[model samples]
Target: MSLHGIGLVFLAVLTGTASVLLAVALLRWWDRGPGRRGARLPQGLDGSLKPMVLLFRGQRLVDATPPARALLDRISAPESEWTRLLQWIGPRFPDAIDGLSRIGRAGRFECLGQSGTGSATLRLLVEQIDSDLLRITITDPQAEYAGIVVDSMSQQAMEEELDLLRRSLDQTPMLVWRQDAEERVTWANAAYLRKAEAQADEPIGWPLPRLLDSPRPVPGAGTRTRRASLTQNGAVFWYDCHSHPTGDQTMMFALPADAAVRAERSLREFVQTLTKTFADLPIGLAIFDRQRHLQLFNPALIDLTSLPTGFLTARPTLFDLLDKLRELRMVPEPKDFRSWRQQMSDLESAAATGHHVEEWSLPGGQTYRVTGRPHPDGAVAFLFEDITSEMSLTRRFRAEMTLGHSILDGLGDAVAVFGQDGQVIMSNRPYRELWPGAESLAEALACWQAGAEAGSGVAALGARLTQAETGLRDTGLMAGPQGQLLGWAVTKLGAGRQMVRFRLPDPAAAALADDKAMLASAG
Candidate 1:
């Protein structure tokens, strides 16, 4: 063979070797598709990449990560749940026939039964593929770290945290609890356990029927009652219970003491606030019996009565108060003022009617208004106000009116008074000087309003002065034989009546003569 031919053969062999290596690499990459394509899956049991695994349902652990071991260690059931884990395994691994064929596959593993493997810790794997291949890369928590792995450390940490949490719950003045699927106490921190001991005679693990308010059909371990607590073995606890369904089990918790105490405090505060509001009311308030005796009275009543020594003075009878009022001139003295007889009659009539007794009045120069009503339950309510200034102003106005009438009469001219209804009520004797034939002041008013010597408009003016009022002051003019009488008149007496006055301008000599004649006549 030639040197060039040998070189060509060597090159071909190298090419063939490279091809085989490429095929092997491709096969490995394809088998790990799930792990190579981004972060597609969670970590495996040993925190390695999640390799392709074969699982048999009902025969393996539920979780496939290190955290799962720490978590599952707390579960009460481990082997009993194996049948459930078998459902998670692939179909091919458990269905195979040849054991050798199952054990021959490499890079395909399983979670070999957890057993003592001569060492405390060891990497566990099946190193074979079969009908129920459970490929896994497991590290025995007891072996790899020589019993120093997360099993002990994580458990210690969890227990410490639980202790701290228990202390927190115990510090509160409340009962706290955790219940199992059967409503039996699965866990009870110190506070709840003590209370339970006081109420229930049994310790933990007691049957839920003897411990809780179980439903008739047991509610399948997931039923709960609100505002209710487990009463284990004659023990009673108050709580609001709620059940959380986790697979075939349940969990429950509650806090009762704090809730009830807070509710009671709120109700008491509300009642106290209501009572204070009624007691401190600003309005004068009083309660009287059917016999007219005072039962309850507030500070406002005392201030109104101005009882210098206080109202507790001898429990004065109703008649006694009336007598005192009369003596003080606060009430009309029957001996001095019989005129109030009509007012008393009106009051009786008002009481007989359904009208509540109410009136405006002034006491010792203070004005007030009061109202009284009968209580349906044989009591009475009285409300009053002060109105003194208004009544005083009214009396002053009446006195001034009388004085004005007297001055008008003293004018030596014919003076007259008319009621608001347009009827003449009073007049001086001098009115006859103007019309001697007039019999009464009413007849004189009729003639003057008729204006016998006046034009049509003047008489109409007299009629208009008596027109219904529109609640406003009105003025009108009346013509008479007295030559443009200049009788300024105003309609103020209501219902069309006016205060009409007139006088002829006195001639200088005639006025002097009249003044002297009147004086001489007086003499």
Candidate 2:
């Protein structure tokens, strides 16, 4: 055989061997699949056909599988990839981040998702790749190993319930948020976000800004509440913040309190105005509550009662106030202390049911008109009025009237005064004796006509009594019922009144008149 022929056979054999090796390598690569070859998932998570895996170095995201990347993309948050991933996973596995510390000691740890998260088989796996690197794996063990079978009806119901809850939280007017042990906000509802945005100069991001100041000595077990305020666009908004501890985190809710705050402010202002008005009042006023404790008083009360300001300001009970007044001699002197107490008890009862009035004649010669009135809600009010001057004036006027009446009774002639309405207003003792039953002007005129002669000027006296003119006077002679000579006169008085008088003619004047008549007859 020739040498060239042997070399050609060996070259052909080598080329055939190389081609077989290349074909075997291509077949093995095709069997590995795109998931295993294209994206490098975490070690244990590679078995999943579509694993959601993320790798983080400290707080920065080093890498993520395609599914994890898609999840991060679906979450709309202005935060880094690590924060975005945590936001997605935290609701399902609340302890996901908390368990990371344990991974450093244990190398790897697993946690189950919260119940009612739609899938009971959900799990999260955290592994410490190194001192600074962490690998997080989220999967459904049932779906991966045992095959997941779902009831469509139950799934739809759960989805509907979740949607309703989401809508309710978002549409609520209250601001709700959850905070971690570090007092950093982890989650917030739509309302909270809107408020944060309104107050913030920049766009809101992850770890949402806290709307209310964190309560000191962190709330535990039960709920704690406080009032909080926020200013937006120069307008202040008020809220009642309620915080309730939930597991390792806290759930906080802020309800609108603007209306309540405004109402309280208005009530305070109204009370201030009432206090000012009472201060300037002239009438002494003291108001006691339903419990009989002094609640309100005026400056006039202090001046009139002469009670110590400190004692009044101490809010003394009704009995205490009365006892102090007795000690000060500001009240009427009672027969005894026991009787005074009984009287006060009755006064209180009467005042509560209706009005009560009493005149206190003090030892200091001051008369006080104390009035008690029932106030709303079973309360009683006492008004102390110093009526000393008024009482003195009234007594003096009454004495003057008595003196005037006595002077009229001492007159020698019968005098009667008639009012404008033709009613007999006043009569002296002699006048009453002269006309026994002349109670009015008409009756008096009838008596006079019956006693006097027909041409005795009785008609002229009636006309003068009835006239509206003042300061008119007339006098004449008349024959009495006993045939005796009588002198009569009518004088108009003030206020359309008239005075009528009657007296017997003097004997001396009658004799002189007789002598004159005799002389005239002889001539």
Candidate 3:
């Protein structure tokens, strides 16, 4: 009951109260570990309302909320996949576990329910509390961003990164797409939707194979581009697609190849048409390309040149072809061996201007007409035609005409021939002497009046000959100015021709001419 006893008891009560308060503070600090500092779960979520959440230390599932536990029980099948926490989460559980184990500090991924569980996509968020601890919260993906706060700098950086990714995908000239194991379209860039002629909203859940007529490449095959086609805007579009497999999905890149395919088709058809046309050519044809290589030849060429088909098919150069032609005696040989190369060069130059021509008279008495012409694309075409028969006929006709002229010259009578156009085309030597003053038969007839006034009776001969050529014949007598008597005849020669001949008269005609001239003057 003294003062010292009362002070000691008050001190003991104060020490006990201090000790209890310190213990409570220590317990509170222990409960609020690094997990609380880093966790971003919803602040006001009740125990019953919050989505499933689980924490892992290394590979071990150390803690789980009530919803998490319930989900694990519902998904786990004791007979099959109930061995570990990862297996209990069902399909794609290893992906989640790998992320949780290997993430640097924080990460997020999508987890989908397997079979017919009807669970919406879960957005799994994982944060590292310490080097060995990871806190995971799986929530509805739609609400995953609800309780998260980001600093301005970090948010700006993320937005920039997202914008760069979007621009990269949109600006690329190729189509980029991603498909799940079931071959359904999960993501496609703007290029892909445009190529498929589909709206952006239609690609999700679309069957990727339906967009093209090509079959999917087998899995594990090396990455090789395969050609495929699509019908868009009522026209066929072509693509060369390259695929890459990653985990359970495939990524594809497609480049437009429609132009290349169309070009090839056009070239093929053009060649076919050329072949058909050349097949029927009678004249030998040889077409060389821009590089001076023999690109085409007809069957007539093979037969005309007597060259082997294989040699022509090998696409020999123009010089080589010419050399072969010389060796085969198909071309005319040049006289000077030293100038042959220059001659060939000159031939090429002349062919470029499309004026090269040559006649080949071969050892076998055959003649060929060869012509060189310019073709498209800096090419040249050579044509060969056999003209032996035509030349032979022309020579024969000239010889026959010369023989006929010799026979006509032997006749003593003055002879003149008129052609179909009423032109004097021929006169024998005697006829030229008889009509020394006239240049032609028509001129002689015009001057006959002068002869008649000088006492010659040949005035009506020209009119009679003209009538004979039109299906009439006349015979008459006449005298020249030297007081000689003559007999003349106008005869039809068929084919619109007439011949006029004059001969010395008999004795009776000579006497009759002299007496008739004196009697006419007296009358």
For 199-305, candidate 2 gives per-residue lDDT tens digits of 89999898888878745335444777889998889988899888888888888888999999999999999999999999998779999999999999999999999
* Model 1, global lDDT: 0.51
Pick by TM-score: 2 or 3, better one: 2
Which sequence of candidate numbers ranks them by TM-score, best first? 2, 3, 1
Alpha carbon lDDT of each predicted model: 0.51, 0.82, 0.70
RMSD of each: 23.6, 17.7, 18.9
Q: State which candidate has the highest lDDT.
A: 2
- What are the per-residue Cα lDDT tens digits for candidate 1 across 67-182? 43433444455464443223222222343223324554543444432222122232334443345544443344443332333343344445555767767877865444455555
Candidate No. with top TM-score: 2
Predicted candidate 3 versus true structure: per-residue lDDT over 1-523, tens digit per residue: 9999999999999999999999999877766777565553353353224445677777677888665665566543654222444554435344676665457644444454332222234445677777877776655444434322112212333454577899899889878888877777888887776666553345544564336433355777856578888766578878888878877877778888988899989999999998888888778898888889998899988877898999999999988988888888776667875587788888887887776898888767888888999987899988888888988998899999888777777776878877777677887777777776555556767655454543334645766655544433376667654556667787778887878887844557669998999999999
- Report the number of clashing residue pairs per model: 39, 0, 0
Using all chains and alpha carbons, the TM-scores for the candidates as numbered come to 0.30, 0.61, 0.50
Which ranking of candidates, highest lDDT first?
2, 3, 1
